[model samples]
Target: MVRTCFYDRISEKRIAAEALARQKLQEALDAPPAVIEPEPVAVVSLQPARNELTVAGLHLVMPQGFNFRDIDTTLEKHGHPVTFCAKRRPAPDELTLQRSVELYVENLRKNYPDVTIVRQSDRLLAGSPAIALDYIFTAGQERRHGRATSALINAVDGDERQWFSISTIINPAHAELADWLIEFDAMLDAIAAN
Candidate 1:
């Protein structure tokens, strides 16, 4: 359908610009969300560090005090061309919860063409609202794929308010625990602000 736009009486050019901007934004909002759900991988329990570990707004429950390794680094090291990776970022205090999550996913999509967005959603985490993004990516060196899940959580460092972006990835073929994927939610649920 053809639509007509009305501009302000003072400037037709300004009206056209505003209309164009609105159209672009509307198109983006109307675009289908890109969320890919790959076949589920087997899960295995990862040994937690004996003491609870905390980072970027997440308190990891590692009852056994097992040496802690970030999932992304482990993926980079586990084999050639196979990277099961996740990331944790200190969300700049300026961005709102949703914007931080969107920018993070958009950065991933822009930097890596192979990123497959598995899912994105919002949830209450640690008494604050959080956004979660689950996705998969292909490693060029090994021609292997890895699945990852990420969440953005709120925190406070003394009087300064802060936020964190937490993510995790796993190599399906090489993971140690059976049914390992199951614990991601539990872990996220356990996130506590320090």
Candidate 2:
């Protein structure tokens, strides 16, 4: 689109210069949004689980069905946001799986009240972490014997807003878990533009 700016300076040259400036401004405004490419973030793995789930120097030895509510509650009390993982029994088919993951997402939405859920298929692809924003919580479930895992990494921003990756899951296992952590950190770093 073309735009024009007029100056009442009786000089034709001044009016012409202002008009050219306006034209350039209009061109810039008409341009599309800049495509932002995420730069790689250096990710370090959590020390081996040894006898428990360890990350960020915290060693948690919790049983199956154990929700890390204590850790989350404490973080909330202290004014820091916390994100933690929760697991559920797998559904036998895609429709059921979708419902199951959606229920889980809704639970996260209701309970945490301050975190965001990033859902993906429970399947652990050959690649470390497959990042996609899809409704299907876990992919390749039938191929993987119905086993799936989720992870939540919580942190606070400078403004003290409770941010969430609360309902996100990574496939369980030492290597895949580690890789997921690394990639997740990269994803978060990219999101943060850090």
Considering every candidate listed, which one attains the maximal TM-score?
Answer: 1
User: In order, what is each prediction's RMSD in angstroms?
Assistant: 17.8, 16.2
52-127 in candidate 1: lDDT tens per residue?
5456689877645454344444323334233334444444557677676677778877867788777777664444
Model 2: per-residue Cα lDDT at residue 107: 65
- The CA-based lDDT of model 1 is what? 0.54
TM-score of each: 0.46, 0.29
Best by lDDT: 1
The per-residue C-alpha lDDT of model 1 at residue 174 equals 62
Our model 1 lands, by Cα RMSD against the true structure, at 17.8
lDDT of each: 0.54, 0.38
Error of 2 at 84 (Å): 5.1
lDDT of 2 at 30: 98
> What overall lDDT, based on C-alpha atoms, would model 2 receive against the true structure?
0.38
